[model samples]
Target: MIQQGDAIPSVAVKLVNKSGVIDGDSATIFGDGRVILFTVPGAFTPTCHNNHLPGYVSAGEALRTKGVNRIICMTVNDHHVVSAWADASEALGVVEFIADGNATLTKALGLDKDMSGGGMGTRAIRSALVIKDGIVEAVFTEDQPGQVTSSGAPAIVEFLESMPS
Candidate 1:
């Protein structure tokens, strides 16, 4: 998996917005800015729906106040699923959702998680990356699925608080 200070792969990701769809890459979307890229194994899953997504949504402003330019929630699901989940969660404006349908970026970063036995197929593991200017500043990943500790919004908030102002 990618580590702190590692330059994030400039992998292509389909960014879905209410306005329309746009082709984006990490180096560009997160370019010249501080960003929080949080990933969930699957959208609408119990833990992700109840905690991960909402946590970031609730902490969006605080994270930006601390210098984060964009906060994104991503998964290996398609755009339709992501859109519906975002709508359901009311996370439209607060957090952008990226559809990595093929787990392109996830695999590129070496964070792919196999859930095929569980019938979900390949997905990104639960992880978060604090990237500044396209370089990872901090990385947090949970060892077990359905557990959001180091990668939760509050944890990211604390991580930001610990950074030099």
Candidate 2:
């Protein structure tokens, strides 16, 4: 898995918003400035709906206050699904929803966790990364998919606060 200080993989990813969809390279996204990027297994899933996504949604401005240029949430879902989920979750403008349909960024970062045995197919491990200028500054991932201790918003916020200004 990609670790702290490693440069993010140069891969393409798609994101959807009220304005429509846009595609960009991962390096371009992270290399621009500081970003708080979080991944979910699927949109509207139990934990992701109630907590994971909501956490970042609520923390969006705060993260920005701490020097984060963007707050992004991604999943192995399509543009339509992700866009709808963001609208339904009230995270539309707060947290940018990205579609990692083929696990492109997930696999490149080595954070892809298999869920096919349970019929969910392949998905990203529930995790968060702090990237600055295309380099990973910190990574937070839980031991299990359902648990969110290490990977949750609070953990990420605290980590962000601790970074040198």
- What TM-scores do the predictions have? 0.96, 0.95
Question: For model 2, which pairs clash?
Answer: none
Candidate 2 global lDDT: 0.86
Candidate 1 weakest lDDT stretch, 10 residues: 17-26
Q: Best candidate per TM-score, number?
A: 1
lDDT of all predictions, in order shown?
A: 0.89, 0.86
Candidate 2 residue 162 Cα shift, in angstroms, is 1.6
**Candidate closest to the true structure, highest lDDT:** 1
Give candidate 1's error at residue 161 in angstroms: 0.4
Q: Tens digits of per-residue lDDT for model 1 on 1-165?
A: 899878988988888766646788867887778989999998899999999999999999999899998898889998888888888999878899898999998898888988899999999999999999989999899988789999999999999999998
